[model samples]
Target: MHLPLDIDSVKGFLDPAEGRALHDAALAAAVRGPVLEIGAYCGKSAVYLGTACRTAGSVLYSVDHHRGSEENQPGWEYHDAELWDHAAGAMDTLPFLRATLRRAGLEETVIPIVGRSAAVARFWTTPLAMLFIDGGHTLEAALEDYRAWAPHVIRGGTLAIHDVFPDPADGGRPPFEVYTRALASDLFEEVLGVKSLRILKRL
Candidate 1:
């Protein structure tokens, strides 16, 4: 079905090729429960996945602290102002996203969880059909997110992670480090993607 919202404009924050692939994957999955998205930055990825969740008869749980990372834009002069505006803008995106989904006849789907993933997961017991992790890039943050969420993903469900590669110049550890460490436990096997995107399925 053709959606009332324009896909291209809604996904401006995502790289075209990668976003399309991820959207296709989400669409093709046999999702039996709700989908969880770790980061909803400007609602670009949310628009993509939310639409797919609607198609699959599932709801999307979008989680984000809305506190932009220091590593994301080092020396950000307007950090406070930008954060305030970003959070405000993020609040605005939620209704817009809901409208887009509703226009696409997906109003029944798409739930926004405005907080840290760890905190949000505490309220749910249903095994997630898909988990998209795009939260913090730091090892501790990523590892904590993974540890808290992975147990709730059903077997054969997909877990996708973004920004997994480390740039030595960026300093400190990357989420890829945490992902690699997690993979060592034999619970998940990394599925490659363009650049730093990684997917794994529960074994």
Candidate 2:
């Protein structure tokens, strides 16, 4: 299937190789309803997943408050001045996310949810074909994200966690912890791994 936007044009940390792997996995797994993403950021991963969902006759719900996460704050290491809202004194990514969807002609295929993922999860009753969690990397935040959304994935659906680094020197361990917890819970089984991305199937 053809995608309207160039994948390289989007901004985010997802490596090209990993993004393609995610794209393929989402496409294969999304044989039904929407593939939900916990962190939309600037819509980089959204584009990848949205394209696949669209091709599969599914949808992509990109969820985020748009107010940058802790690590994205002005003083944080991953802060992007370009995303800062000076007047509001916060980082806002909603506009860029909207533009990305529009440019990609995915307005009909991708739905943007503006709010903290946990807050949205409170009211989210729909079953997901695939859930991609890349929101916060802190232990508390990562665990919250997992607790709020993991159960919503239907049995046999896919759950993907990004930025998992087993070695502390490589990166934070929150994501890896979530991955391990999922395995221990016996609710999910590892299905695939592409770089730092871990794909598991709800059992």
Candidate 3:
């Protein structure tokens, strides 16, 4: 299926190749139930996954507080001043995300949950076909996101994590650690890796 959204126009880190892989993975998983994404930065990944799900008649629930993570804050290497909302005194991506989804005509297929992933997980009871984790980069936040949402994935579902660089020089190890831990737990089996994107099938 053709992606309805223009990935290049969105502000995010996902490579087009990884995004395409995510799209295929989400399409396969959506056969069982709706997909869930931990972060929705300007709807880049959302457009990829959401477009695929929409074609399959499924939905995507994007959970994010719209507050930039540690590395995305001012003075950080990944910080982007364009995302800052001076009036709100915070890093806000909600407006951009909404506009992106609307532009892609995916507003109806992708549902945005404006809150912390952990907080939303507490009340989440639906079984997910796919769970994409790309919210916080810190070890603490990454682990919390996994702990809260991984088990909620139904058996045979997909558990995808982003920014998994095995080499320390390339990037931080938190995401790689999460990938390894998820492997050691024996609850999931590694299936695919597109660049820093890692996909596992829930056991």
- State which candidate has the highest TM-score: 3
Residue range 143-185, candidate 3, lDDT tens digits: 9999999989999999999999999999888899999999999
lDDT of 1 by residue, 7-73 (tens): 6655234665656656766775536677888877556677667778777877888787655555444
**Would you list the C-alpha lDDT of every candidate in the order shown?**
0.67, 0.90, 0.93
Ranked candidates (TM-score, high to low)? 3, 2, 1
Model 3: which residue pairs collide? Answer: none
Residues 6-33, candidate 2, lDDT per residue (tens digit)? 8778878999888888898899878867
**Candidate 3 TM-score over all chains jointly:** 0.98
Question: Which has the higher TM-score value, candidate number 1 or candidate number 2?
Answer: 2
> What lDDT score goes with residue 113 in model 1?
74
Candidate 3 residue 98 Cα shift, in angstroms, is 0.3
Model 1 clash pairs?
none
All candidates: TM-score: 0.78, 0.97, 0.98
